[model samples]
Target chain A: MSTTLGRISHGAGLILVLCFTLFPFYWMVSSSFKDQADILASPPVWFFTPTLANYADIFADEKVFGAIVNSLIVATLTTALSVLLGAPAAYALARFEFRGKSDLWFWFISNRMISPIVLALPVYLLAVQLRMLDTYLVLVLIYLTFNLPIVVWICTDQFRSIPSEIEQAARLDGADQFTIFRKIYVPLGLPGIAVSAIFSFIFSWNELLYALVLTRRSVQTAPVMATSFMSGYELPWGKIMATGTLIVLPVTIFALLVSRHMVRGLTMGATK
Target chain B: MRKGGEFVERTETRLNPGYGRWTPFWFLAPAVFALLAIGIYPMLSALVTSFRRYNITRPREGFPFIGFENYANVLSDQTFWQSLGLTARFFVTVLPFQLLFGICIALLLHRPGLGMLRSLARVSLVVPLATTYAVVGLIGRLIFNRDFGVANQFLNAIGIGGMDWLGSPTGAFIAIAVMDIWQWTPFCALIFLAGLSMVPVEIEEAARLETSSKVALLRHVQLPYLLPGLTAMLILRSADILKLFDMVFVMTRGGPGAATDLVSIYIQRVGFRVFDMGTASAQAILLLIMTIILSRLYIRLIYKEIE
Candidate 1:
């Protein structure tokens, strides 16, 4: 009887917590489908006739497609650059010895904590001087600073987890440093690279500050475009939700697909 | 053949003397260069700008070096103090609730016999994490709209009078805080889940054997183990929150009489809107100092824990 009661209480608690946690996400998706009138109706429209009109409006009128392309380009480039640069740096930090190595590692990691707001002003002036405002290159370069540190930090752990013997054996077999990295370390660290790529992509895609400050019109990413929906005198709830849902979908799906890996990546030096 | 092989080995050894020390530097070069250009250089410029009497309006005309004037003005500025106070209030109010709710949800999900539910719970919680702040602000605006918002609708249905969510100072603060909690609790939960997984099964089982009380088990066993992860999460989240701008920018634009204004919003307004580059740089410097101090404290705490 005691065991039964314990199980019942645990089950009840789990259900309640799960419901509370999930209801907001459900509402976001549900409300996105509702028309403007239905959305404002009393008693909160939990059930309603769904429509793609909001999505259509976002695509056709809001120029959200352009923003999507901009986000993809920036995120993809940032991820590629972070992985290419950060992976080997992580390998070197993990496997090799050098002077000022710990200092270098800490300095690299501390870059993550530097608030972007402090950098925004000078970057703006610099961007203006360089005539690089509202350009993809500018956004990618700014994001690389943020993404590369995270990649190095995460990939360092991943690289450390791999045994040194494997790389040594490859080296003994006449494999050059580049070949060993390509054949041994890269293959072994593929998952870590994937996690880093996903993280960098998400960080760049979701980034708002640089995108807002640098881009004016032509190169605005989705987050900036989404902010514009709320800018003018009147708020456009329908289009905002529609664009938001679509913008969130790609990262949400990727996050869900590799959540386990993400967790490992996140907690990478935590346990040790 | 042996001699030739030995020669080849010697050449290889000379060429690569054990995991080439320059490899990491070569790999780290581009990232370091980018960080210098985009990160360190800009920061140094801000530090320099903060010391000068630079105004954005007078871009062509150079300003004289006014050592400490910007900082002095910032120190005397009442709005900066208010913004800092409001930011402290916001952090203090929200961090605890987020941590509690996060741990609770993580614990709930850690139980057995919830196979499919577990997966669903994870994904659903991550949706909010993946959602952009701009979207969160927009959604929050809709839900918290004064007249026709669903929040007011629910209040009216429950016989509570409608409150102006973003119209008043207190309301605006609450609304922003609520939005933050909704978005960030999942992040805390994710970290807690990662930490919880590291808890030893034997300790938990032993606690369960001794006392079937959930609270007791958590208090004596789990909480101690969770301390380091919690501290790390707190530091990361606090740092991120101190720099928060996007959601508040979208929600109220630091409006309803600057009551809900944070340090970041104030800096943006002063710098970009008013074009008081000198004042703004000073304010940015102050914020940077505060963040560095707080993060140093956090690092010390984490290091103590590790020791």
Candidate 2:
């Protein structure tokens, strides 16, 4: 009886947790398809004729297309740049010993702790002075504040995890250090590096404060554009929900694709 | 780990002959340079700006040196203090529930048997984690809408009246916290799951045989092993929750009053709205110090063993 009760309670608890996790998303997606009146209906219209008007209206705005393009370009460039710079640094940190090695590692990792707001003011000011505002380059560079550290940190662990014997055997066969590094370690560390890339992409994609402060109408990202709906005189609940859904869909799909890796990526490879 | 280090050291010695000392430097230089340019340079500028009067809006009056005035002004400002207090309240309110529920849910999902249910729960949980903070805030607004939100409808169905979630101060605060908890509890659970998986099954089974109580097993067997993950999660989450801006900006815009105002929003307002760069920089510096101190504390406490 007790074991059965335990099983029953366990099943109930799982359902409860699942609901808490998913209900808001359900509301978001459902309301995106809802008409304005049905969205505000008191009994909460569980059954209604779904509409695509919100999605239609959002897509019709040229600014919305600009935002999506900007988001994609910024996130992709940031990921690419971070990996380019950070992987070699991580490899060096992992493979070589030098004076201040620990200190350098700590410094790189500690960069993650610096609040985005702390950097926002000066970066914004610098962007204005340099006439770099509303440009993809500025956002991509600023995103390095978080992305580079994550790439270096996670990739260092990745490099460290590869058995040294494999690399040593290559070295014994007269493979140069650079060739061995490029040929051997890069392929082995790709999984962890990919995880790091995902994190950087998602952060840059979802970033708002910097995007909001730095960009004008021309370069506004989707997330920043999504907030413009909130400040408008009319609520535009359907459109807002629609935009929110769009903003969330790409990353949600990406997260699900890497669901198995989510646990490791999120913990920054600490737990593993 | 030491063997790998030694192997690298030997390789460096072989590769460079006499100047292996400088080998890693070449690899590290670019990353460090980039950090200095983007991260350190801006920080140093903010530090300098904090000590001077430099409002972009008032460009006619050039940025002049004003030693400690900005810091003094921020210290004396009641709104600044209130926002700081509210930030603390927000952190205190949200983190515990997230930690508690996270652990509970993690424990539930960590249970050995239920195969498909466990997989489904884990997958569903991380959906919120994938969504942006701003979108989560927008979702919160819809869910906690005074009239037709799903939350109120659910409450009404269960015979409770709708509450003004974002209207009043307390309600707004709770609403924000709830939103945070909902979004992040899954995060905490995932981290905990990762930690739980590290525990030796033998230890758990042994503890279980010794004591029929789950709490006892967790306390005597699991908690000790889970400390590192807990500390890591705590550090990660604390750093994040302290810097929360996008959520509050979208949900309440720091509120109907200054009810839900946090330091991030406060600094943004002073910097942008009022164009008081000096005060904003001062506040930012202060926030930076607090963040460093708190993070250092978490790191030292939790990471002492590794060091």
Candidate 3:
């Protein structure tokens, strides 16, 4: 009786939480499929004749396609650069003991705490002066800085978790430090690096404030493009929902691909 | 674990020719240089701007050095204080609910015999986290629509009747809080789930023999393991609330008569909208100081074990 009650209560609780959490996503996606008439229905249409009109409308605008491409380029490069730059620092911090190493570690982690608004204002001015505004290069650079901390933080944990005997054995066996890092740590630490990369990609992809302030027309990202729908008077409910669905689709799939690492990644290795 | 690595490194330094003294510095240089350039340069510029009269709107004014005046102006502004106060209130109100719901859901998912359901539920939970803040804000606009929204529809179903959600101050504030809870609670649950995983199966089984009450089990066996995660979650969540911009900006543009003017939105307007770099930089600096204090505390908690 107790076990059965436990099962039932836990099962019921999970369902309720899932419903509450998934409801908005359901509304977003269903509204995206609804036609103009059903989209604005007062009772909130639970069923409707699905239409491709919203998708067609969004795709017709060349800017939407451009925004997606921009988002992809920015997110991909940011992930690549963040991992590349951060891994070595993490490895050093993990394996080597140098003076002020703790301070260095603290500095990298603390960098994550600085407000984006604080950086965005100055970076915006500098970008304008350098004519770097709205370029993928500028966005990637800014994102790299923001993402570096997570990469360093998680990968440090990953590198540390590896048995230090491996390093000692590799050194005894006539392996160079870089080679050992490349041969052993890289393969072993790939999971943590990948986690950090996922975070970098997602953060850069979804980021709005920087893209909103910096990019105007040519280099606008997907999130920025989605917000543009609201500035217009009519509020294009169908198109907004459709755009939101498309913007969220890629990241959702990407996140699910590595859901196992997500708990560790989400907390930045603080827990797991 | 580190002792072995340190010994290996010491051997490399004395015995191996390949283990150069500058190896670590070389490895760390590119990232360090990049972070310093990106982090410090902009901060220094902002610091300089805060004490000067630099409004981008009037370039002719030429960014003159006016000592502490910008700070004074921001200090005197009613909107600045009110927006900061409102954001603090938002954080205070939202954190506990997110924590409660998150812990409750995490408990459910962490229960014994929740094998397949846990994985599926956890994956679906990522959908909300993966959704961008701006998209969430857009969804907020739809969900809280006074005319045809799900919020009012649900309220009406429960005999509360339809009410304007984004048009009134209290309603709009609640709407922001609701959306924040919706987005973050899953995150809290995920963190707590990880924390729960830390409890040894043997210890838990032993504890189960002593107590049938889930509450007691959690209070005694579970909550202890949850502290580190709880601290991390609280710090990250509060910081995210302070820096919240995209959602509130998209939902109401900090409107309904300044009802949802969270600090970031307020700063966005001052810095971006008005091009008042002086006052905006000062406001930004103020936020930075507060963040520094909190993060310093969090750093101690997070690095306690690793160091």
The local distance difference test score of each candidate is: 0.80, 0.86, 0.88
The candidate scoring highest on lDDT is 3
How much RMSD separates candidate 3 from the native structure?
A: 2.5
lDDT of 3 by residue, A1-272 (tens): 98888788878787787798888888999899888788778978787899989999989988898899989998999899999999999999998877899989988888877789999989999999999998888888888767999899889989989987787788888898889889999999988888888888988899999999889998899999998889766577988899899999889888887777776676666776
lDDT of 2 by residue, A1-272 (tens): 98999899999999998888998899899999999999878868899999999899989988777788989999999999999889989988888767788777777777777778899888888998999998888998999988998899889988989987887778778776677779998999999888888888987899999999889977899999988888756599998998899889999988887777776666555576
**Clash count per candidate:** 0, 0, 0
- Lowest-lDDT window of 10 residues in candidate 2 chain A? A263-272
> TM-score of model 3 relative to the true fold?
0.95
DockQ-derived CAPRI band for the predicted complex in model 1: medium
**Quality of candidate 3's docking, in CAPRI categories?**
medium
Poorest 10 consecutive residues by lDDT, candidate 1 chain A? A263-272
Residue B140, candidate 1: alpha-carbon lDDT: 81
Residue B267, candidate 2: Cα error in Å is 0.6
Q: List the lowest-lDDT window of 10 residues for candidate 3 chain A.
A: A263-272
Q: What is the lDDT of residue A189 in candidate 3?
A: 93
Candidate 1 segments exceeding 4 Å error: A1-5, A261-268, B1-21, B298-307
